[model samples]
Target: MGIRVGTRDDAEAIAEVHIASWRVGYAHVLPESVLYADDFEPRRRAIWSEWRFAPTQRVAVSVDDTDRVVGFAAYGPERERARGTTGRGELYAFYFHPDVWGNGAAAGLIDHVGERLRAEGFDEAVLWVLDDNPRARAFYERHGWHPTGIAADFDVHCELSVPEVEYHSPLTVEGRP
Candidate 1:
C-alpha cells in the first residue's frame, strides 16, 4: 500500500469511507439512519465541502498498488484543551476505514502526520475519542497516548450529543518507543 495527499477528485471515495466508518465504528452509539440516511447527495456534498477545505489539516489517504484509496486520515495543528497545551501545537484528527483496520494503515497515518507536525516544530499531539469506543481507546493507549480524564461535549448529527475522552502524547510518543 502507498499513501498520498487527498485532492478534490477523492471526495466521493472519502465520503464512502466516512460513511462506512461511521456505520462500523459507531454501530451501537449512533442511529443507523444517521449514516445510512436517504440523503446521500447532501451528505456527500457536505463532506466534500468540509473535508476539502478544513484548515490546518491535511488528508492523507492510503491506496493499493492499483491506486485505490482504501483508508485516509486528516491531521494538523490545533489547540489542545486536553493536553494542558495552551500554546503547544497539536494534531486534531486521525481515522482509517474499517477495511484496513489491522493492516498497519493506522500506524502509517500517525507516521504521516508526525512527519508533518514535526517538520512544523510541533513536538506533541492530542485527540479526543468517545470514552465508550474501547476499540479506538485501546488503540490509542497502545500507541502511547495517556488519558487526561478530560471529557468534553461532542455533537453528532446535530441532534445527538455525547462526551469525549481526551488523550495526549508528547514528542517521543510517551510510552511507546
Candidate 2:
C-alpha cells in the first residue's frame, strides 16, 4: 500500500476510481445517468485538465503497488461563507472507492489535505457532505468535523436542490482530533 502526490498523468486511473466510487457508494444518491453513464471518463478528464492549471490546489492520490488510485482529496482556497468566518481553506472533494473504505485510506487522505491546507495558510477547513450519508457524516465527526448548518444548493445529482450539510474543523494538524 502506498500513496503520493497526483499529477495530470494520473487522470485516467483517477477517473476510473472516481466513477467506481460514485457507482458503488453513491448509487442511491446520485442520478443513475450521471453516475452510471459512459460519459464519466470524459467529465473526469475535463476536471483533471482544469485542475492541472490551478496552483495552490492539492491532490493526494492513494495507490496500490501498481499505482492505481483508490482514493483522492483535492481542495484549495476559502470561498463563500467559508471565508467569511474561518478565513481558511475549503475542501472541494474528498472521496474514496468504497472497496477501500475502513482501510486507513480516508485518514491518510484527510491528513494529507489538512497538512497541505495548514502549510498554505489556512487555519480552518470545511467540507460539504450529503445529509443522508450517515457513514460519511459519522466518519467526519470522528475526525473532529462538525456541522455548521450552512446548507447549500448541491444539486449535482438530483433534479432539485439537494440538502447538503457543511462540516467544519477549526483545529490545525497540531490539534487533537
Alpha-carbon RMSD, each predicted model: 2.9, 2.4
- Which candidate tops TM-score? 2
Tens digit per residue, CA lDDT, model 2, 42-151: 78768777763377677778887787788887778766762366466777777787788889878867777777788777778888888878888998898889998887
Alpha-carbon error at 51 in model 1, in Å? Answer: 5.0
List, residue by residue over 1-177, the lDDT tens digit for candidate 1.
888988878877777777777788988887776767777447756876675547666777888788877777666665656444554445455556788889887776666666666666677767788877988888878877788778887877657787888777775643221
Pull out the clashing pairs in model 1: none
lDDT of 1 at 126: 72
lDDT of 2: 0.75
Q: In model 2, which range of ten residues has the least summed lDDT?
A: 78-87
Off by over 4 Å in 1: 79-86, 173-177
